[model samples]
Target: MGILDAKALRDDIVARLLTDEVDLETSAYLDRILELAEMEEAEHQFLNDPFDRSVALVLQLFQDKDLDPWAVDLSAFLEMFSTRIEDTEDIDLPTCGRLIRMAWQVLRGQAETLIERQNHEDEVDEPWIYDGGWESDFDDNDYNFSVGIITGTHKERLPDMFSGRIQREEGRPVTLGELLMGLKAASRISEEQNLRLKIAEKRRASLEMARERFSGSLHVEDLEGDIRRTWEAMRMRANPEDQTCTLSAISEELADRSMESGTIREEANAEAQVAAMVATLFLVNRGYASIEQKDAIDGSVILTDLHPDESDFEELSLRLHPPPEIEEAV
Candidate 1:
């Protein structure tokens, strides 16, 4: 295809991707596979031998809903299989067994790695927990001592009473000091007001840190919402009829054009939008939603009311867009 044709192809693909009808990342993987086929002379060979089932099989396999084409780990696949294939040409039993063993090892390893990578990525992408207070190293004894001092407890009588209780329970002689320490260790303040105050303080600190990081301009939630809205809009616009195009295909095309024009800001924005759309689509498909009901809703349904939690919003945004940069306070 000419440069113009490639550009056109990219536009069509992007249109499909933005419509939410096609899997963008999967489309990108298929495009890569096609490109590799072209480079390896397989494209022309498949054309000449149109009846070649392998070509169709490969393409169909890439498009399979159950298969994760992006997580194929092609480099690892090649590394494992290429050497084994090179060493054997016979259709004999021993050679076949070795190839099977190597293939199994490669597949098992790739599957394990893919799962691990996905889990790690998910953990990294999740929003940080804001418990509203620092996790303390102070023990119960210290806490009790602080509480006793604040409450004005008679230190002497309290210890004697605690020691008597301990002696009864343990069937042994216990000192007043030791009993006091034990009581202190066992005691915990169960005041709801105090806990709430600590949480409020922590939340204030978190909000301040976030504001400083965003230069008091954008809330993390707002930036995240913008990306998600853009993505959802794009998905709603996608056409399900286009089988060959995807969001990733469009992204790569946009990225190329943006690079050519030196429009870094535009490119970054485009990347973020695409990532958000792709991520949202993937999550929705995978049954990760506030409401797990998947009805055949019209494309025109407004996504504004779909109140996804912050973590989900962030995941959707990061998937479709460039990762947000945490700016250092000046």
Candidate 2:
């Protein structure tokens, strides 16, 4: 498809994503899954294997703790944290109790960062951020580098938190050749699920209600109201209007609420977490109010409102709809 067509399709999907709170929540879940999906086989075995699950959990905890990415010594860390038990029929490891300890200690009291250890800092130190040379055309001097499907972010701060070379189907976290692959495959299925809605209405009353709700007559009121409505529709216990929220926070809130209501709190899988992030990103980019994540740890995508005086909408108005440049007179 053409760029414009793809953009239009993306807009359509995004609009649908906005309308349904489930979509928002699911997208957030998917984002995390994509991050975990750094491993090519991670997703397939995640649900089935405990070791893979443990690794994903460890990775998430590492991220949530805001520990150094390069600090991770996967083999050593796994050795230290794994639960050493005799292999059972259900869970098959190489030998005795070689499995990830579910509740391994990560955070220290009043510590600014995740951990105090510097096990593998030297391994991460390299002049060029990228391990493999995918982009033949890229040079050392260019400020920003794009290699085919992937784009590098932390050029100035090489081998830092989010700096790396990659080509992913969708952008989420850094994935090396043998790491995360944040592939996002959605759209047709979502549309197919919604097909029944096109003709479900036996009465026009719902249409009238929708029209009344979305008159789109007022400017400021409409914008403010939309934001408020989105906040409401999410139905989160704590308001993220002015404060930052995280996947963990939302999970805790939802779990508590569910328990209080005597409903079982089902875990939000990797896909759901990743899906929820889409909504968060959408709100950050388009929601009139500016926001930021409370911390590097815990809240990955949930943003706290910044309430900037001037915004992209204000600054880009002229550029977006510029009058035709006056031609030079002959």
Candidate 3:
């Protein structure tokens, strides 16, 4: 989407190169991707040669690497990526040019997906306690926080779901980041609740229908009519503008669209989490652009100075009882 910077991508691949420890297969694929990237960026029509068909398979591999490749089917993708190339030999210069362009598009999409997923996964869902001790409570448990946005721990949804939870418990001033974090959490929780309610209603209706079948009084036409009426009701409720999808699923969709941006969500001890949230708010309202959690256990925050021109007098004023006034040097 962005200017298709193939040279930059090629350089990036070269820098990483990847190790076989992860997956020899994926590593080899990377090698092929990098090779094709270099040739394509160099504007070489070398794919027209007798062995150029293999290059076509490599190019197809890029195209088949889309988000929902299963829709295209593995056999179909295999044929397109590898076998389909066997049919073409001594391809024309124009075709070679098209293949080069297509290869760039495919590889770029795959790279964008990698970057997008990594960015989402890295979101700062900070530890609820030091050294991940919170894991002990919910290690094998799954949470259904408002539904679709289920996290392994409430920590994922809490800061985002309820700001008051953070404020009341943490008892500290909240930060803009913390507020945004809570809004995002709340939005996710709301979406999940909607999904859950819809799913529950559907299941309940199915159960009622199953019970009705046991009564054995309904004719086929009657059953059809009932189904049709339900269908009509669903159609009436379906709004094209309604976007009540799971937040992570929405995130995955955005990734497929080749764009990316997100934020970290934090949830500590309700008190600890809320305290950190409030502490963050304190710094944010004071013209601090950001607050970094240095020690959540101790409710410490670094109010990032967005305006370096200003002094730390505000920061100093927040300080009190410093080393007991150094005993006034006695």
- Top lDDT prediction, candidate number: 1
| Residues 65-174 of candidate 2: C-alpha lDDT, one tens digit per residue | 44333233332333332222112212232211222222122212112231221222222322323234332345655434334224545454445424465554455545
138-169 per-residue lDDT for model 3 (tens digits): 42223444343554545565565544433434
Tell me the tens digit of each residue's lDDT in model 1 across 19-49. 2244544454446434544543432233322
Error of 3 at 214 (Å): 61
Pitting candidate 1 against candidate 3, the one with the higher TM-score is: 3
The whole-model lDDT of each prediction reads: 0.39, 0.35, 0.37
Off by over 4 Å in 2: 1-230, 233-247, 254-263, 268-275, 294-302, 305-330
**TM-score between candidate 1 and the true structure:** 0.18
TM-score ranking from best candidate downward: 2, 3, 1
The segments of candidate 1 whose C-alpha lies over 4 angstroms from its true place after superposition are 1-26, 43-144, 149-330
Worst 10 residues of 2 by lDDT: 2-11
